[model samples]
Target: MAVELIILGVLALTAASLWIPYIVGVNTAPDGSIPADAPDGFIIPPDPNVHRPWVRRAYRAHLNLLEQSVPFAILVLLVDRVDGFSALTLWASIAFLILRIAHAVGYITGTARFPGRPLIFTGGWICCLLMAWAFFAA
Candidate 1:
Protein backbone atom coordinates (compact mmCIF):
# COMPACT_ATOMS: atom_id res chain seq x y z
CA MET A 1 0.00 0.00 0.00
CA ALA A 2 2.84 2.40 0.70
CA VAL A 3 4.33 1.73 -2.67
CA GLU A 4 0.93 2.31 -4.15
CA LEU A 5 0.69 5.64 -2.32
CA ILE A 6 4.04 6.75 -3.62
CA ILE A 7 2.96 5.91 -7.14
CA LEU A 8 -0.23 7.87 -6.60
CA GLY A 9 1.72 10.80 -5.29
CA VAL A 10 4.04 10.69 -8.26
CA LEU A 11 1.05 10.62 -10.55
CA ALA A 12 -0.49 13.61 -8.79
CA LEU A 13 2.70 15.57 -9.33
CA THR A 14 2.59 14.48 -12.95
CA ALA A 15 -0.97 15.74 -13.16
CA ALA A 16 0.05 19.10 -11.72
CA SER A 17 2.76 19.33 -14.32
CA LEU A 18 0.10 19.02 -17.01
CA TRP A 19 -1.04 22.56 -16.27
CA ILE A 20 2.16 24.06 -17.64
CA PRO A 21 1.32 23.10 -21.21
CA TYR A 22 -2.37 23.96 -21.06
CA ILE A 23 -1.62 27.37 -19.64
CA VAL A 24 1.10 27.81 -22.20
CA GLY A 25 -1.18 26.87 -25.08
CA VAL A 26 -3.97 29.13 -23.97
CA ASN A 27 -1.51 31.95 -23.54
CA THR A 28 0.04 31.32 -26.94
CA ALA A 29 -2.97 30.52 -29.16
CA PRO A 30 -5.25 27.71 -30.17
CA ASP A 31 -2.47 25.91 -32.00
CA GLY A 32 -3.91 22.62 -33.17
CA SER A 33 -0.39 21.34 -33.23
CA ILE A 34 -0.47 19.92 -29.69
CA PRO A 35 -1.88 16.47 -29.19
CA ALA A 36 -4.01 15.17 -26.30
CA ASP A 37 -6.77 16.84 -24.30
CA ALA A 38 -5.84 19.61 -21.89
CA PRO A 39 -6.29 18.70 -18.26
CA ASP A 40 -8.58 20.77 -16.00
CA GLY A 41 -6.16 21.89 -13.30
CA PHE A 42 -4.06 23.71 -15.84
CA ILE A 43 -5.89 26.66 -17.22
CA ILE A 44 -5.98 27.57 -20.84
CA PRO A 45 -4.98 31.17 -20.47
CA PRO A 46 -7.90 33.36 -21.55
CA ASP A 47 -5.83 36.09 -23.16
CA PRO A 48 -3.55 35.35 -26.09
CA ASN A 49 -1.51 38.41 -25.18
CA VAL A 50 0.50 36.39 -22.64
CA HIS A 51 1.48 33.63 -25.03
CA ARG A 52 5.02 32.30 -25.25
CA PRO A 53 5.54 29.47 -27.73
CA TRP A 54 8.91 28.25 -26.53
CA VAL A 55 7.75 28.11 -22.97
CA ARG A 56 4.63 26.31 -24.16
CA ARG A 57 6.77 23.69 -25.86
CA ALA A 58 8.87 23.32 -22.76
CA TYR A 59 5.73 22.87 -20.70
CA ARG A 60 4.52 20.35 -23.22
CA ALA A 61 7.70 18.40 -22.59
CA HIS A 62 6.92 18.26 -18.90
CA LEU A 63 3.42 17.15 -19.77
CA ASN A 64 4.99 14.56 -21.97
CA LEU A 65 7.00 13.13 -19.10
CA LEU A 66 3.84 12.85 -17.05
CA GLU A 67 2.15 11.21 -20.00
CA GLN A 68 4.87 8.62 -20.41
CA SER A 69 5.89 7.90 -16.83
CA VAL A 70 2.42 7.11 -15.48
CA PRO A 71 1.98 4.11 -17.73
CA PHE A 72 5.34 2.74 -16.72
CA ALA A 73 4.44 3.12 -13.07
CA ILE A 74 1.20 1.28 -13.72
CA LEU A 75 3.14 -1.52 -15.28
CA VAL A 76 5.37 -1.71 -12.24
CA LEU A 77 2.34 -1.72 -9.98
CA LEU A 78 0.82 -4.58 -11.87
CA VAL A 79 4.02 -6.53 -11.56
CA ASP A 80 4.18 -5.76 -7.89
CA ARG A 81 0.63 -7.01 -7.48
CA VAL A 82 1.51 -10.30 -9.00
CA ASP A 83 4.99 -10.83 -7.62
CA GLY A 84 5.11 -8.59 -4.53
CA PHE A 85 7.40 -5.72 -3.73
CA SER A 86 11.05 -6.52 -3.35
CA ALA A 87 14.00 -4.30 -2.43
CA LEU A 88 14.31 -3.64 -6.10
CA THR A 89 10.67 -2.63 -6.33
CA LEU A 90 10.97 -0.05 -3.60
CA TRP A 91 14.25 1.39 -4.78
CA ALA A 92 13.24 1.42 -8.41
CA SER A 93 9.93 3.10 -7.74
CA ILE A 94 11.69 5.75 -5.71
CA ALA A 95 14.30 6.28 -8.37
CA PHE A 96 11.69 6.37 -11.10
CA LEU A 97 9.72 9.07 -9.34
CA ILE A 98 12.80 11.13 -8.59
CA LEU A 99 14.10 10.89 -12.11
CA ARG A 100 10.74 11.79 -13.55
CA ILE A 101 10.52 14.83 -11.31
CA ALA A 102 14.05 15.82 -12.19
CA HIS A 103 13.41 15.23 -15.84
CA ALA A 104 10.35 17.46 -15.83
CA VAL A 105 11.95 20.28 -13.89
CA GLY A 106 15.33 20.15 -15.59
CA TYR A 107 13.93 20.04 -19.10
CA ILE A 108 11.32 22.70 -18.54
CA THR A 109 13.55 25.03 -16.54
CA GLY A 110 16.48 24.32 -18.87
CA THR A 111 18.92 24.79 -16.03
CA ALA A 112 20.57 21.39 -16.22
CA ARG A 113 22.75 20.69 -19.25
CA PHE A 114 23.69 17.47 -21.02
CA PRO A 115 24.97 15.55 -18.01
CA GLY A 116 22.01 16.51 -15.91
CA ARG A 117 19.60 15.39 -18.60
CA PRO A 118 21.50 12.16 -19.00
CA LEU A 119 21.54 11.58 -15.28
CA ILE A 120 17.79 11.87 -14.95
CA PHE A 121 17.04 9.93 -18.09
CA THR A 122 19.45 7.20 -17.04
CA GLY A 123 18.01 7.17 -13.57
CA GLY A 124 14.57 6.50 -15.03
CA TRP A 125 15.91 3.70 -17.17
CA ILE A 126 17.77 2.28 -14.22
CA CYS A 127 14.50 2.14 -12.38
CA CYS A 128 13.10 -0.01 -15.13
CA LEU A 129 16.16 -2.18 -14.94
CA LEU A 130 15.54 -2.60 -11.25
CA MET A 131 12.03 -3.72 -12.05
CA ALA A 132 13.42 -6.24 -14.47
CA TRP A 133 15.84 -7.43 -11.83
CA ALA A 134 12.96 -7.94 -9.46
CA PHE A 135 11.05 -9.88 -12.08
CA PHE A 136 13.99 -12.18 -12.68
CA ALA A 137 14.87 -12.43 -9.00
CA ALA A 138 11.29 -13.33 -8.14
Candidate 2:
Protein backbone atom coordinates (compact mmCIF):
# COMPACT_ATOMS: atom_id res chain seq x y z
CA MET A 1 0.00 0.00 0.00
CA ALA A 2 2.46 2.62 -1.10
CA VAL A 3 1.24 6.16 -1.50
CA GLU A 4 1.88 6.11 -5.20
CA LEU A 5 -0.10 2.92 -5.63
CA ILE A 6 -3.02 4.31 -3.71
CA ILE A 7 -2.98 7.51 -5.71
CA LEU A 8 -2.68 5.50 -8.91
CA GLY A 9 -5.72 3.45 -7.95
CA VAL A 10 -7.73 6.57 -7.23
CA LEU A 11 -6.73 8.18 -10.49
CA ALA A 12 -7.56 5.04 -12.43
CA LEU A 13 -10.96 4.74 -10.79
CA THR A 14 -11.71 8.38 -11.45
CA ALA A 15 -10.75 8.04 -15.09
CA ALA A 16 -12.83 4.88 -15.38
CA SER A 17 -15.88 6.65 -14.02
CA LEU A 18 -15.59 9.82 -16.09
CA TRP A 19 -17.45 8.26 -19.00
CA ILE A 20 -20.72 8.45 -17.08
CA PRO A 21 -20.89 12.24 -16.97
CA TYR A 22 -19.75 12.70 -20.54
CA ILE A 23 -22.10 10.01 -21.81
CA VAL A 24 -24.99 11.39 -19.84
CA GLY A 25 -24.23 14.81 -21.22
CA VAL A 26 -24.08 13.37 -24.70
CA ASN A 27 -27.35 11.48 -24.45
CA THR A 28 -29.25 14.22 -22.67
CA ALA A 29 -28.13 17.04 -24.89
CA PRO A 30 -30.90 19.19 -26.31
CA ASP A 31 -29.21 19.44 -29.68
CA GLY A 32 -28.95 15.70 -30.20
CA SER A 33 -25.32 15.08 -29.42
CA ILE A 34 -24.90 12.29 -31.89
CA PRO A 35 -25.81 11.81 -35.48
CA ALA A 36 -29.08 9.96 -35.70
CA ASP A 37 -27.74 7.84 -38.54
CA ALA A 38 -24.76 6.51 -36.59
CA PRO A 39 -24.70 2.74 -36.16
CA ASP A 40 -25.78 1.31 -32.84
CA GLY A 41 -23.42 -0.43 -30.40
CA PHE A 42 -20.37 1.21 -31.84
CA ILE A 43 -18.31 3.65 -29.85
CA ILE A 44 -18.75 7.19 -31.01
CA PRO A 45 -16.66 10.06 -29.78
CA PRO A 46 -18.89 12.56 -28.09
CA ASP A 47 -18.84 16.06 -29.49
CA PRO A 48 -18.63 18.62 -26.72
CA ASN A 49 -19.83 21.39 -29.00
CA VAL A 50 -23.32 19.95 -29.10
CA HIS A 51 -23.63 20.13 -25.35
CA ARG A 52 -24.43 23.05 -23.09
CA PRO A 53 -21.51 24.86 -21.49
CA TRP A 54 -21.12 22.73 -18.39
CA VAL A 55 -21.65 19.55 -20.33
CA ARG A 56 -19.08 20.62 -22.87
CA ARG A 57 -16.69 21.31 -20.03
CA ALA A 58 -17.48 17.92 -18.55
CA TYR A 59 -16.58 16.18 -21.78
CA ARG A 60 -13.36 18.13 -22.11
CA ALA A 61 -12.48 17.61 -18.48
CA HIS A 62 -13.02 13.88 -18.75
CA LEU A 63 -10.86 13.65 -21.85
CA ASN A 64 -8.11 15.71 -20.29
CA LEU A 65 -8.10 13.54 -17.19
CA LEU A 66 -7.85 10.39 -19.27
CA GLU A 67 -4.94 11.81 -21.20
CA GLN A 68 -3.07 12.72 -18.04
CA SER A 69 -3.88 9.53 -16.16
CA VAL A 70 -2.38 7.20 -18.71
CA PRO A 71 1.16 8.47 -18.41
CA PHE A 72 0.88 8.97 -14.66
CA ALA A 73 -0.35 5.46 -14.11
CA ILE A 74 2.28 3.97 -16.33
CA LEU A 75 5.06 5.89 -14.63
CA VAL A 76 3.86 5.10 -11.13
CA LEU A 77 3.53 1.41 -11.85
CA LEU A 78 6.89 1.30 -13.52
CA VAL A 79 8.47 3.02 -10.55
CA ASP A 80 6.80 0.67 -8.11
CA ARG A 81 8.01 -2.31 -10.03
CA VAL A 82 11.54 -1.16 -10.71
CA ASP A 83 12.56 1.16 -7.90
CA GLY A 84 10.19 0.59 -4.97
CA PHE A 85 9.34 4.11 -3.71
CA SER A 86 10.76 7.32 -2.32
CA ALA A 87 9.91 10.78 -1.04
CA LEU A 88 9.89 12.00 -4.62
CA THR A 89 7.32 9.42 -5.60
CA LEU A 90 5.23 10.07 -2.52
CA TRP A 91 5.12 13.85 -2.93
CA ALA A 92 4.58 13.54 -6.65
CA SER A 93 1.69 11.17 -6.06
CA ILE A 94 0.01 13.46 -3.55
CA ALA A 95 0.59 16.59 -5.58
CA PHE A 96 -0.56 14.96 -8.79
CA LEU A 97 -3.85 13.79 -7.29
CA ILE A 98 -4.51 17.24 -5.95
CA LEU A 99 -3.62 18.97 -9.20
CA ARG A 100 -5.68 16.55 -11.23
CA ILE A 101 -8.70 16.92 -8.97
CA ALA A 102 -8.44 20.67 -9.08
CA HIS A 103 -7.92 20.69 -12.81
CA ALA A 104 -10.89 18.43 -13.42
CA VAL A 105 -13.17 20.43 -11.18
CA GLY A 106 -12.03 23.73 -12.54
CA TYR A 107 -12.40 22.63 -16.12
CA ILE A 108 -15.78 21.01 -15.55
CA THR A 109 -17.13 24.04 -13.72
CA GLY A 110 -15.70 26.50 -16.22
CA THR A 111 -13.54 28.07 -13.56
CA ALA A 112 -10.35 27.15 -15.32
CA ARG A 113 -8.98 30.32 -16.87
CA PHE A 114 -5.94 32.16 -18.09
CA PRO A 115 -2.80 30.41 -16.87
CA GLY A 116 -4.49 28.53 -14.05
CA ARG A 117 -5.68 25.40 -15.85
CA PRO A 118 -2.55 25.09 -17.92
CA LEU A 119 -0.42 25.50 -14.84
CA ILE A 120 -2.32 22.79 -13.02
CA PHE A 121 -1.96 20.47 -15.99
CA THR A 122 1.75 21.20 -16.21
CA GLY A 123 2.13 20.45 -12.51
CA GLY A 124 0.53 17.07 -12.99
CA TRP A 125 2.71 16.41 -15.99
CA ILE A 126 5.73 17.29 -13.88
CA CYS A 127 4.55 14.83 -11.29
CA CYS A 128 4.52 12.13 -13.95
CA LEU A 129 8.03 13.00 -14.92
CA LEU A 130 9.01 12.94 -11.26
CA MET A 131 7.60 9.46 -10.93
CA ALA A 132 9.72 8.36 -13.88
CA TRP A 133 12.70 10.10 -12.37
CA ALA A 134 12.16 8.41 -9.03
CA PHE A 135 12.79 5.06 -10.69
CA PHE A 136 16.33 6.14 -11.41
CA ALA A 137 16.94 8.56 -8.55
CA ALA A 138 16.01 5.99 -5.93
Candidate 3:
Protein backbone atom coordinates (compact mmCIF):
# COMPACT_ATOMS: atom_id res chain seq x y z
CA MET A 1 0.00 0.00 0.00
CA ALA A 2 2.83 2.40 0.74
CA VAL A 3 4.43 1.62 -2.58
CA GLU A 4 1.14 2.14 -4.32
CA LEU A 5 0.76 5.51 -2.61
CA ILE A 6 4.23 6.52 -3.74
CA ILE A 7 3.41 5.59 -7.31
CA LEU A 8 0.24 7.62 -7.16
CA GLY A 9 2.21 10.58 -5.85
CA VAL A 10 4.66 10.30 -8.72
CA LEU A 11 1.87 10.17 -11.25
CA ALA A 12 0.26 13.25 -9.72
CA LEU A 13 3.56 15.10 -9.89
CA THR A 14 4.03 14.09 -13.50
CA ALA A 15 0.62 15.48 -14.33
CA ALA A 16 1.51 18.74 -12.55
CA SER A 17 4.87 19.06 -14.27
CA LEU A 18 3.22 18.98 -17.71
CA TRP A 19 2.30 22.62 -17.08
CA ILE A 20 5.92 23.61 -17.70
CA PRO A 21 5.62 23.17 -21.45
CA TYR A 22 2.27 24.89 -21.60
CA ILE A 23 3.56 27.86 -19.59
CA VAL A 24 6.67 28.14 -21.72
CA GLY A 25 4.64 27.97 -24.90
CA VAL A 26 1.96 30.48 -23.96
CA ASN A 27 3.30 32.80 -21.27
CA THR A 28 6.17 34.39 -23.16
CA ALA A 29 4.85 37.25 -25.26
CA PRO A 30 7.12 38.87 -27.85
CA ASP A 31 7.27 42.20 -26.02
CA GLY A 32 6.88 40.57 -22.58
CA SER A 33 3.44 42.08 -22.34
CA ILE A 34 0.03 40.53 -22.48
CA PRO A 35 -1.40 40.47 -25.96
CA ALA A 36 -3.34 43.67 -26.54
CA ASP A 37 -6.19 41.63 -27.94
CA ALA A 38 -6.47 39.56 -24.80
CA PRO A 39 -9.65 40.14 -22.88
CA ASP A 40 -9.15 41.51 -19.39
CA GLY A 41 -9.26 38.54 -17.07
CA PHE A 42 -7.13 36.30 -14.90
CA ILE A 43 -7.40 33.62 -17.54
CA ILE A 44 -6.40 34.60 -21.05
CA PRO A 45 -7.04 32.35 -23.96
CA PRO A 46 -3.97 31.34 -25.88
CA ASP A 47 -3.97 31.49 -29.65
CA PRO A 48 -3.48 27.96 -30.83
CA ASN A 49 -2.22 29.06 -34.24
CA VAL A 50 0.72 30.86 -32.62
CA HIS A 51 1.91 27.79 -30.71
CA ARG A 52 4.61 25.58 -32.23
CA PRO A 53 3.86 21.99 -33.08
CA TRP A 54 5.62 20.56 -30.04
CA VAL A 55 3.96 23.14 -27.85
CA ARG A 56 0.59 22.22 -29.21
CA ARG A 57 1.36 18.59 -28.68
CA ALA A 58 2.50 19.28 -25.12
CA TYR A 59 -0.70 21.10 -24.35
CA ARG A 60 -2.79 18.31 -25.78
CA ALA A 61 -0.84 15.72 -23.85
CA HIS A 62 -1.36 17.69 -20.67
CA LEU A 63 -5.08 17.90 -21.35
CA ASN A 64 -5.24 14.19 -22.03
CA LEU A 65 -3.42 13.44 -18.77
CA LEU A 66 -5.77 15.66 -16.85
CA GLU A 67 -8.77 13.93 -18.38
CA GLN A 68 -7.46 10.54 -17.38
CA SER A 69 -6.00 11.46 -14.00
CA VAL A 70 -9.27 12.21 -12.26
CA PRO A 71 -10.76 8.80 -12.80
CA PHE A 72 -7.42 7.12 -12.27
CA ALA A 73 -6.92 8.78 -8.92
CA ILE A 74 -10.42 7.98 -7.78
CA LEU A 75 -10.19 4.34 -8.74
CA VAL A 76 -6.75 3.90 -7.24
CA LEU A 77 -7.71 5.41 -3.93
CA LEU A 78 -10.90 3.40 -3.76
CA VAL A 79 -9.06 0.21 -4.47
CA ASP A 80 -6.26 1.04 -2.09
CA ARG A 81 -8.65 1.63 0.75
CA VAL A 82 -11.09 -1.15 -0.02
CA ASP A 83 -8.94 -3.98 -1.28
CA GLY A 84 -5.42 -2.88 -0.26
CA PHE A 85 -2.64 -3.56 -2.76
CA SER A 86 -2.88 -6.91 -4.46
CA ALA A 87 -0.27 -7.96 -7.03
CA LEU A 88 -2.70 -7.29 -9.85
CA THR A 89 -3.49 -3.79 -8.58
CA LEU A 90 0.15 -2.97 -8.00
CA TRP A 91 1.23 -4.11 -11.45
CA ALA A 92 -1.66 -2.32 -13.07
CA SER A 93 -0.68 0.91 -11.33
CA ILE A 94 2.91 0.63 -12.48
CA ALA A 95 1.87 -0.21 -16.02
CA PHE A 96 -0.45 2.79 -16.05
CA LEU A 97 2.35 5.14 -15.05
CA ILE A 98 4.72 3.74 -17.65
CA LEU A 99 2.13 3.82 -20.41
CA ARG A 100 1.15 7.38 -19.56
CA ILE A 101 4.80 8.43 -19.75
CA ALA A 102 5.14 6.77 -23.14
CA HIS A 103 1.94 8.38 -24.33
CA ALA A 104 3.14 11.84 -23.34
CA VAL A 105 6.53 11.39 -24.95
CA GLY A 106 5.04 10.04 -28.17
CA TYR A 107 2.55 12.85 -28.36
CA ILE A 108 5.14 15.57 -27.76
CA THR A 109 7.58 13.98 -30.19
CA GLY A 110 4.93 13.58 -32.92
CA THR A 111 5.34 9.82 -33.01
CA ALA A 112 1.66 8.96 -33.03
CA ARG A 113 1.89 7.86 -36.66
CA PHE A 114 3.69 4.80 -35.35
CA PRO A 115 2.35 2.20 -32.95
CA GLY A 116 3.70 3.90 -29.85
CA ARG A 117 1.29 6.57 -28.69
CA PRO A 118 -2.06 5.03 -29.48
CA LEU A 119 -1.02 1.69 -28.11
CA ILE A 120 0.29 3.21 -24.89
CA PHE A 121 -2.88 5.22 -24.43
CA THR A 122 -4.99 2.10 -24.93
CA GLY A 123 -2.80 0.18 -22.54
CA GLY A 124 -3.20 2.87 -19.90
CA TRP A 125 -6.95 2.68 -20.28
CA ILE A 126 -6.78 -1.06 -19.93
CA CYS A 127 -4.73 -0.68 -16.79
CA CYS A 128 -7.35 1.61 -15.40
CA LEU A 129 -10.03 -0.92 -16.19
CA LEU A 130 -7.95 -3.65 -14.61
CA MET A 131 -7.59 -1.62 -11.45
CA ALA A 132 -11.32 -1.19 -11.33
CA TRP A 133 -11.77 -4.91 -11.83
CA ALA A 134 -9.48 -5.62 -8.87
CA PHE A 135 -12.01 -3.95 -6.59
CA PHE A 136 -14.67 -6.44 -7.63
CA ALA A 137 -12.35 -9.42 -7.69
CA ALA A 138 -11.19 -8.70 -4.16
Candidate 4:
Protein backbone atom coordinates (compact mmCIF):
# COMPACT_ATOMS: atom_id res chain seq x y z
CA MET A 1 0.00 0.00 0.00
CA ALA A 2 1.09 3.56 -0.60
CA VAL A 3 2.31 5.61 2.35
CA GLU A 4 -0.53 8.07 1.81
CA LEU A 5 -3.13 5.31 2.11
CA ILE A 6 -1.49 4.00 5.25
CA ILE A 7 -1.33 7.50 6.70
CA LEU A 8 -4.97 8.02 5.86
CA GLY A 9 -5.90 4.88 7.74
CA VAL A 10 -3.85 5.95 10.72
CA LEU A 11 -5.44 9.37 10.70
CA ALA A 12 -8.95 7.91 10.64
CA LEU A 13 -8.27 5.48 13.45
CA THR A 14 -6.56 8.12 15.52
CA ALA A 15 -9.44 10.54 15.14
CA ALA A 16 -11.96 7.83 15.98
CA SER A 17 -10.08 6.89 19.12
CA LEU A 18 -9.35 10.41 20.22
CA TRP A 19 -12.57 10.45 22.18
CA ILE A 20 -11.28 7.84 24.58
CA PRO A 21 -9.26 10.24 26.69
CA TYR A 22 -12.07 12.75 27.06
CA ILE A 23 -14.54 10.02 28.02
CA VAL A 24 -12.11 8.72 30.53
CA GLY A 25 -11.66 12.18 31.90
CA VAL A 26 -15.41 12.57 32.28
CA ASN A 27 -15.86 9.24 33.98
CA THR A 28 -12.90 9.74 36.25
CA ALA A 29 -13.71 13.19 37.52
CA PRO A 30 -15.04 12.49 41.01
CA ASP A 31 -16.59 15.93 41.40
CA GLY A 32 -18.77 15.58 38.30
CA SER A 33 -17.52 18.80 36.88
CA ILE A 34 -18.47 17.53 33.45
CA PRO A 35 -22.15 17.83 32.71
CA ALA A 36 -24.08 14.85 31.40
CA ASP A 37 -26.43 16.89 29.21
CA ALA A 38 -27.64 20.35 28.29
CA PRO A 39 -31.36 19.78 29.17
CA ASP A 40 -32.89 21.71 26.26
CA GLY A 41 -30.98 20.32 23.34
CA PHE A 42 -28.96 23.46 23.29
CA ILE A 43 -25.87 21.31 22.98
CA ILE A 44 -23.34 22.97 25.16
CA PRO A 45 -19.80 22.93 23.97
CA PRO A 46 -16.85 22.11 26.16
CA ASP A 47 -16.11 25.09 28.33
CA PRO A 48 -12.55 25.49 29.40
CA ASN A 49 -13.67 27.43 32.46
CA VAL A 50 -16.64 25.29 33.52
CA HIS A 51 -15.52 21.74 32.88
CA ARG A 52 -12.71 20.10 34.75
CA PRO A 53 -9.43 21.15 33.28
CA TRP A 54 -8.50 17.70 32.09
CA VAL A 55 -11.93 16.98 30.68
CA ARG A 56 -12.16 20.26 28.86
CA ARG A 57 -8.71 20.02 27.37
CA ALA A 58 -9.18 16.41 26.38
CA TYR A 59 -12.54 17.16 24.78
CA ARG A 60 -11.06 20.02 22.77
CA ALA A 61 -8.20 17.84 21.63
CA HIS A 62 -10.60 15.17 20.45
CA LEU A 63 -12.71 17.72 18.59
CA ASN A 64 -9.72 19.30 16.96
CA LEU A 65 -8.62 15.97 15.48
CA LEU A 66 -12.15 15.25 14.25
CA GLU A 67 -12.35 18.69 12.65
CA GLN A 68 -9.07 18.21 10.82
CA SER A 69 -9.65 14.60 9.81
CA VAL A 70 -12.39 15.29 7.27
CA PRO A 71 -10.47 17.56 5.00
CA PHE A 72 -7.30 15.58 5.51
CA ALA A 73 -9.05 12.36 4.55
CA ILE A 74 -10.73 13.96 1.56
CA LEU A 75 -7.48 15.21 0.19
CA VAL A 76 -5.83 11.88 0.74
CA LEU A 77 -8.69 10.09 -0.99
CA LEU A 78 -8.60 12.47 -3.91
CA VAL A 79 -4.88 12.03 -4.34
CA ASP A 80 -5.09 8.27 -4.07
CA ARG A 81 -8.04 8.03 -6.40
CA VAL A 82 -6.05 9.88 -9.04
CA ASP A 83 -2.96 7.76 -8.42
CA GLY A 84 -1.16 10.99 -7.61
CA PHE A 85 1.93 9.84 -5.81
CA SER A 86 4.58 12.37 -5.01
CA ALA A 87 7.27 12.93 -2.39
CA LEU A 88 5.65 16.19 -1.33
CA THR A 89 2.28 14.60 -0.62
CA LEU A 90 3.91 11.69 1.14
CA TRP A 91 5.88 13.99 3.42
CA ALA A 92 2.87 16.17 4.06
CA SER A 93 0.81 13.18 5.08
CA ILE A 94 3.50 12.04 7.46
CA ALA A 95 3.89 15.54 8.82
CA PHE A 96 0.16 15.79 9.35
CA LEU A 97 0.07 12.61 11.36
CA ILE A 98 2.95 13.74 13.52
CA LEU A 99 1.55 17.22 14.00
CA ARG A 100 -1.81 15.82 15.02
CA ILE A 101 -0.22 13.61 17.63
CA ALA A 102 1.82 16.50 18.94
CA HIS A 103 -1.15 18.80 18.99
CA ALA A 104 -3.33 16.33 20.86
CA VAL A 105 -0.64 15.67 23.40
CA GLY A 106 0.09 19.32 23.90
CA TYR A 107 -3.55 20.17 24.29
CA ILE A 108 -4.30 17.38 26.72
CA THR A 109 -1.25 18.00 28.83
CA GLY A 110 -1.37 21.81 28.57
CA THR A 111 2.24 21.62 27.55
CA ALA A 112 1.72 23.69 24.43
CA ARG A 113 1.47 27.07 26.12
CA PHE A 114 0.58 30.23 24.30
CA PRO A 115 1.25 29.90 20.53
CA GLY A 116 2.68 26.40 20.70
CA ARG A 117 -0.56 24.45 20.31
CA PRO A 118 -1.92 26.74 17.64
CA LEU A 119 1.34 26.51 15.73
CA ILE A 120 1.19 22.74 15.82
CA PHE A 121 -2.41 22.78 14.65
CA THR A 122 -1.57 25.18 11.88
CA GLY A 123 1.14 22.79 10.75
CA GLY A 124 -1.48 20.08 10.32
CA TRP A 125 -3.67 22.51 8.44
CA ILE A 126 -0.79 23.36 6.16
CA CYS A 127 -0.26 19.66 5.56
CA CYS A 128 -3.85 19.35 4.41
CA LEU A 129 -3.42 22.36 2.16
CA LEU A 130 -0.33 20.75 0.72
CA MET A 131 -2.23 17.55 0.02
CA ALA A 132 -4.98 19.59 -1.62
CA TRP A 133 -2.41 21.18 -3.86
CA ALA A 134 -0.95 17.76 -4.60
CA PHE A 135 -4.26 16.89 -6.20
CA PHE A 136 -3.60 19.63 -8.73
CA ALA A 137 0.19 19.38 -8.84
CA ALA A 138 0.11 15.67 -9.46
Top candidate by TM-score: 4
TM-score of each predicted structure versus truth: 0.65, 0.84, 0.83, 0.87
Mind sharing the TM-score for model 3?
A: 0.83
How well does model 1 score by local distance difference test? Answer: 0.63
Error of 1 at 106 (Å): 1.0
Instruction: Give one digit per residue, the lDDT tens place, for model 3 in 8-75.
Output: 89989999898787678666635634555665342223445455567778878998888887788888
Tens-digit lDDT track for model 4 on 72-110? 999899999898879999999999999999998989998
Q: What is the clash count for each candidate, in the order shown? A: 1, 0, 0, 0
Model 1, 60-126: lDDT tens per residue?
5665576657666666766666775776687778777777777777666767568887777777777
Which 10 consecutive residues of model 4 have the lowest summed lDDT? Answer: 38-47
Question: Model 2: clashing residue pairs?
Answer: none
Off-target runs (Cα >4 Å) in candidate 4 are: 31-44, 47-50
Worst 10 residues of 2 by lDDT: 40-49
Give the alpha-carbon lDDT of every model: 0.63, 0.81, 0.77, 0.83
lDDT of 2 by residue, 19-80 (tens): 77767766676655556775643224444344567776777788999999998898888888
Ranking by TM-score: 4, 2, 3, 1
Return the lDDT, model 2, position 104: 87
List ranges where model 2 is wrong by over 4 Å.
Answer: 31-49
Pairs that collide in candidate 1 are 27-51
